[model samples]
Target chain A: MNAVSRALTDGWVITKRNLIKIKRVPEVLIFVLISPIMFVLLFAFVFGGAINPGDGVSYKEFLIGGIFAQTVVFGATFTGAGLAEDMQKGIIDRFRSLPMSPAAVLVGRTTSDVVYNVLSLIIMALTGLLVGWRIRDGALDALAGFGLLLLFAYAISWVMAWVGLLVPSVEVINNASFIVIMPLTFVSNAFVPIQSFDGVLRTIVEWNPVSALTQAARDLFGNLPPGETVSDAWSLQHPALYTLLWVVGILLVFVPLSVRQYRLASSK
Target chain B: MAVAGNDGDEGVDELTEMISATGLVKRYKNVEALRGLDLSVPEGKVLALLGPNGAGKTTAVRILATLIKPDEGTAVVAGRDVLNDAEGVRRSIGLSGQYAAVDEHLTGFENLEMVGRLYGLGGVASKARARELLERFDLSDAGDRPSKTYSGGMRRRLDLAGALVAAPPVLILDEPTTGLDPRSRQQMWEVIRELVGAGSTLLLTTQYLEEADKLADDIVVIDHGRQIARGTADELKSQTGGERIEVVLVDDGDRDAAVAVLGQVATGEVQSGDSERALTAAVTGGADSLSQVLAGFAAGGIAVLDIGLRRPTLDDVFLSLTGHATESDTDSDAGSAGGEGA
Candidate 1:
C-alpha cells in the first residue's frame, strides 16, 4: 500500500483497539457522559436564578452553546490522559517496533477521541433539551454548529496529544491540561458573558479562541437573544470565521508537532 | 576470549549472521548503558546475552530491534541496516520486552490480532493468525476474556504470541523470563527452544546462567556496558575454573584452616562466603577435588559441617570475572534457593 493508505489502515486498526476499551470499561464512558450531564444541570439550575444572559434568550438556551463548547474542550483531556497512560505502558514499545506507519498511532488516538466527544455531545444535548435548551436555527445551521464544535475539539485533541507526549505520567497530563484548560474555558464566554470581566481579563477573554468557539456555536445555533448587543470585538463579530481560523491553525501546528513528539517519546 | 570477527574476514561459514552489531554505544543522561559492545548471532542459532541488571543487555536488544538507535554503532539484522533502514529491520525481527506488553483491556486473541494487523496482515488472515497463536500458546481457553484477568505467566505467553504473529526471521527477547516463577520460566524456555528448533535466529538476554546454558548455543557475558566474556556456556564455565567446592565449617575458627585445605585443590582463589563459617573455591577435578579437600580436612582435624561439589553458576562466573556476584544475588531469594537445591 501507498503511504497515505498505509497510515489510514494502520490508524484504523489502532482506532479499533482504543474503541474496544470503551466497550470493555463502560465505567469510563459513564464518567465521560455523566460529567457533561452534571455540568448542564449545575449551570442550568444553580446559576440560572442568579445570572441573566441579559436578553430575551433564556439562560438555558444561551447556556447550551457554552456548555457544548466547554464540554468538548474538556473532552480533549481524554486524548492527553490516554496517550500518557499508553506511554507508561509497554504497549507503546510494541507499537514502536511495528513496521506500521509512524503517524498511525497519533492518528488513531486523536480520531478515536473524536468518537468520545461525539458521544458526550449527544448526551449533553439531550440533557440540554430536557432543561429547555433548543436549537433555534434550522437543521442545516444546527448541524454546522455541532460540526464546528467537533472540528474545534478535534484540533484540541492534537494539542492535548502533544501535551500527553510531553508529560511524564498520566497524572501529570491530567493536572497539566486541567491547569491550562480550566483557565481557557472559564475566561471565555462558555460560562458567563465575557463583558463581565474587567480590564486585562476582558481583553484576554475577548481574544481567547475558546470564546470565539462559544460565540460561533451560539451564532450557528441561533441561540443568541434577538437584538442582544454582540461583542464589538472583531473575533466575536465574525466568530465562525475566527473559530475556523483557530481550528485550521491548531491542526496545522499541533498535528506535526504531536507526530514529532510521538517519534521522540519513550516509555519509562 | 576470542572476539567474533567484526569484518567478515574469518573463514567462510555456511551460516549467515542474522543479527550483527559492532561498537554499540548508548549514553543516557547519567549512565553509559552500552560502551563499544559487539555481538553476532548466526541464523538458526540461539545467542544469550547473560548479564545482571543495568548491564546494557536491554539497550543492545533495543538497538538491534530498531526500537532505539545507538549513539555510536552500526547494526544489521536480517540483511537490513538498523539505522538507515529501520523499517526494514523492524519488518525482519520480532521483539518481546522484559515486561509483558499485551493490552490488558484486549482479549488474548484480540491482542494478537491487533499485532498481526499492525504487521500488515489482512483482516481475515490476522484473525486466523491470532487464533493459531492463541492455540499454540495454550491461551485458546482464555482467548475471549480480557487479558487483565490473565495470570502473570499467561500474560507473558500472550505477549510472546503477539511477537510471533508475523513469524519474523529473527527474534530478540529482552530478559524474557526475568520475573517468571520457576515453572513459568521452564515453560517459556521450552517455547523459545521450539521457536529456535524451527530455524529462527534467537537473541535472548537473561540474568540466569542456567537459562543461557540450557538454551543458548553461545553465551555473551556482559557487565557495566561491555562484553567481559563471549564463548559457549562450557567455555565460560571453564574460564571460571570449572566446578566449585562449597564448604560450611563446624567452627568459625577453622575458616583459615579450611581455606588452606581448599587452596590446594582450587585452581582459582578461594572465596569466603558472607559468613565466616563458609568458604567456596573453584576447582578442576569436580568430585575428585571434593574428595581431595575431604582428605586434607580430615588430616588437619578440622571439623566440616557440610560440603558439596557443584558446577560453576552464573554468580561464580560473574564473581570470577567482575570481582562481584550477579546483582540479583542478594535479593533473588527464590533464585538463590533454587541454586542451593541444585
Candidate 2:
C-alpha cells in the first residue's frame, strides 16, 4: 500500500524467490558455506604466523579480525555478479513491470546476500575457534563484532550491486567485482598491520574501511590493539567505529543511489 | 465503436483509450529507439503496433507497460500518468512478452503463485488465483511441473497466466505470439478475444500482419519510430489505393520483362519479392488495368502462370508505409524457430 510496506513485501517475495532458486540449484549455498570456510582455513594456515600480535595476543586471534573483514568483502563481490546475471537473464525487466517499489528488489537482493555472508562468517568464525583462536571479549562483544561486519558487508554489496547494474555484460562480472574488491581488501590491513607500512600504503590502509572493520573487530575480540587504533565509531576510536560509521554512512548514501540507478535502468 | 487506440489526449475520455502514449522516446546509447512516438489504445478492444526491425513497436509497448520510461513523452495507462503514477499504471495493466517470463526453476503453478504474491495476494488468495489462471490457460495438469520442461507454447501460456494473476484491467502484449505455431497462435488469439469480450482493454505489437488482421480492432503502422498510418484492418486494406496483381514468373529473368511490360499500367507501387521470381504491382482502374496488364505481358512474350485480384493485406499496408516487411522487426532466428518443445 505504502512505500515502506510495499518495499518490505517486494523484498520478502524476492528473497523467497531466490531461496526457491537456491533450493532448485543447490550450488549457491556452497558459497555461503564451503567457499568462505575454505578461504578462512587458507588464511589460518598460510598467513596466521605472519600476523604478529602488537599487544601480546596470539596471531591466530589477531587474524580473526582481518579474516572477518576479508570474508565479508570477498562475499560482497558476488552481489554484482548475481545482479549482472539477473540483468542478462531479463529478470530485472520483469521486475520493472511489477507493482511493488522498484527499490525493494535491490534491497531484498543485497539483504539476502548479507544473510548469506553472515552465515559464512559464522562458519568461518567457528572454524577459527576450533583451531585455537579465542575472543577475550564477552559473547555480546562478539555479536557486536559480527553486527559491524554484516553492516559493512551490506554497504559494500550495495555499491557492487550498482556496479552490476552499470556493467555492460555478465561476462565481465567476476573480473570486475574481483578487480574492484581485491585492491580494497589488500589495501586494508586484512593480512598485516598498517604500521608495518611506512608511507603511502600506510596512509591508504589507515583510511580504508577494510582496515577500519578489522581494527574494530580486533578491539571487540579484545584480541589486541594497534597503537594507532581508536574506540569511538564502532568500538570507539578503532577502525571498527570508522568502519561502522562508513557502513551506515555508505548504506545511507549508496542504497538510495543504487535503487535510483536500478530503477532508471530497469525501467527500459 | 471500440476506438481502443486513442494515442494520448487523456481528456478525450477513458472509454476512448485503453492505453495512450505521447512523445514516447526511448534511447539506448547513441541510437534513438522510440523517437517521438505517439500511440493509443481504446477500451475493450485490440490495437496492434506494426513496424519493421528497429522501428520502435516493441519500445512503445515497453513504455506503455511501465516496464520502461520515455525520455521525452508522457504515457497514461488506464487513465494514470505513466511517469508520475507508475505504480498505478502498473496496477492497471497486464503484460505478456515475446519471450516467456516464467521462472524456469519454478513449476507453472509456482510461477503464477509467485507473481500473485508479488502483487500482494495472501497465500490462500494467491494460490486460488494461480489455480484459476492455470486452468483457464489449460495448464492444470502440468502446472506442478517445472517450467523448464514445458513446451514453448506451454511456457508462454504460463507466462500470460502469470501476468493475469492480478487481473489487471489493461493488457499489453509485445509480439507475444512471434514464434508460436498456428494452433498456439490461434489459442492465444482466442484468449485475447476472450479478454476483450470480458471488457479488458488490450494493446499488442506484432510482426505478423495476418495476426493483426485476425485480432486487432484497429491497427497502427509505424516506421522508424513514427506513426505512418492508423486504421481498422479492412479500412487500411481498402485505402491501399489499387488492387494488387501478382505474377509468379517462370524464372527471375522474366521478372525484368514482366516489370517492363506491367510498368505501362502500374500506376501504383511495384515491388519484387526477395526471390526476384514473383513480381507484384499495384495497378489502378481495377478491371481495365488488369486487362491491359495481361495484354502488355502477352505482347512481350512473357509467360504469365497465374493472375488474380486480391485485397491489400497488412503486408501491402506495411510495404506501402515503410517500404519493407514487418516480420524482419528483430534479429533473424532470434526466438524464431523450433517446433516448440511442447
State each candidate's chain A TM-score. 0.97, 0.90
lDDT by residue (tens digit), candidate 2, A1-268: 8887888888887877766777877787875688766767787788777767566666677777887788788777668877787776656766778787787778778878877887788798888888778888898998898888888888888888888888836568778777777888888767776667667776777777887788778778777754545322332355655777787788888888888888766522
If you assessed candidate 1 against the hidden native complex, which CAPRI class would it receive? acceptable
User: Runs in model 2 with CA error above 4 Å?
Assistant: A49-51, A54-56, A225-236, B1-15, B23-30, B239-315, B324-342
Candidate 1 ranges beyond 4 A from true positions: B1-14, B249-304, B327-342
lDDT of 1: 0.87
Stretch of 10 with least lDDT, candidate 2 chain A: A228-237
lDDT of each: 0.87, 0.75
Residue-level lDDT for B255 in candidate 2: 78
lDDT by residue (A37-104, candidate 1, tens digit) is 99999999988877777778888888889999999998898998998888777688899888999889
Q: TM-score per model for chain B alone?
A: 0.79, 0.74
DockQ of 2: 0.28
Candidate 1, residues B128-234: lDDT per residue as tens digits?
A: 99999999998999999999999888988888988899999999888888789999999998999899999999999988889999999999999877999999998
Give the per-residue lDDT of model 2 (tens digit) for B165-240.
Answer: 8899888887778888989888988988887788888888887667788888888887767888888876777666
